[model samples]
Target: MTAELLEFLEELSRALIASGNSVTDTERILWSVAESQGVEVEVSVLPTMIIIKAEGEVSRMGLAAQSPGMMPLHQVTEIYRLTDDVTSRRMEVGEALGELRGI
Candidate 1:
């Protein structure tokens, strides 16, 4: 996988965690998102971290910390849209990363 893809996966994990998803739920959701976009991804969710393997080439690991409470619906929806845009190629990795950071 390219560095951009790796970075994207890492950011995605962070977003999921920030959106109040448990580590296991984050892995499941991310895998489903990738598969829906026709991408193959392998995810391993540990007690405190998530590891994403993509394109059979690169693996990116990130810390997983759930927010104190539920995230607002709007923010969760926005994150889902951003993930879709990135995985579907509707947005560039850099652009998606920027948008995610802003969120």
Candidate 2:
């Protein structure tokens, strides 16, 4: 699972850069985010990004634009955290997303 996650992160990082996006400090942030989710493995840092794979069961998280997309990690992270059985580390994704005013 860790291997798959790192691989995906590396690929996603490349894709993000190819499309022109700054990933500065993203590795740490992503690791935190992943832990916030239910990903129990360590997020290994690749050349450009961090990787952590989904384990056991994988859920198709969709996007919020209602464009027929899978739910994004940000949306399901808290649920994952809850699933991980940690009751005190919840992050209100909806609230945080609501604060993204101009983006």
TM-score of 2: 0.32
Which regions in candidate 2 have their CA more than 4 angstroms from the true location? 25-29, 36-103
Collision count for each candidate, in order: 0, 6
* Candidate 1 local lDDT, 1-103, one digit each (tens): 2566667777888888777767788788677656655668888876568788877766777786666777789988999998878667787767887888888
Tell me the tens digit of each residue's lDDT in model 2 across 10-57: 443333333333455434544554566446544444343334445643
Please provide TM-scores, in order, for all candidate models, with all chains considered together.
0.72, 0.32
Query: Residue 97 lDDT in model 1?
Result: 78
Q: Give the TM-score of candidate 1.
A: 0.72
RMSD of every prediction: 2.7, 11.0
Q: Clashing residue pairs in candidate 1, if any?
A: none
Q: Quick one: how many clashes does candidate 1 have? A: 0
Task: List pairs with backbone clashes in candidate 2.
Answer: 61-70, 61-71, 62-70, 62-71, 62-72, 63-70
- Residue 92 error for model 2, in Å? 22
Error of 2 at 52 (Å): 9.4
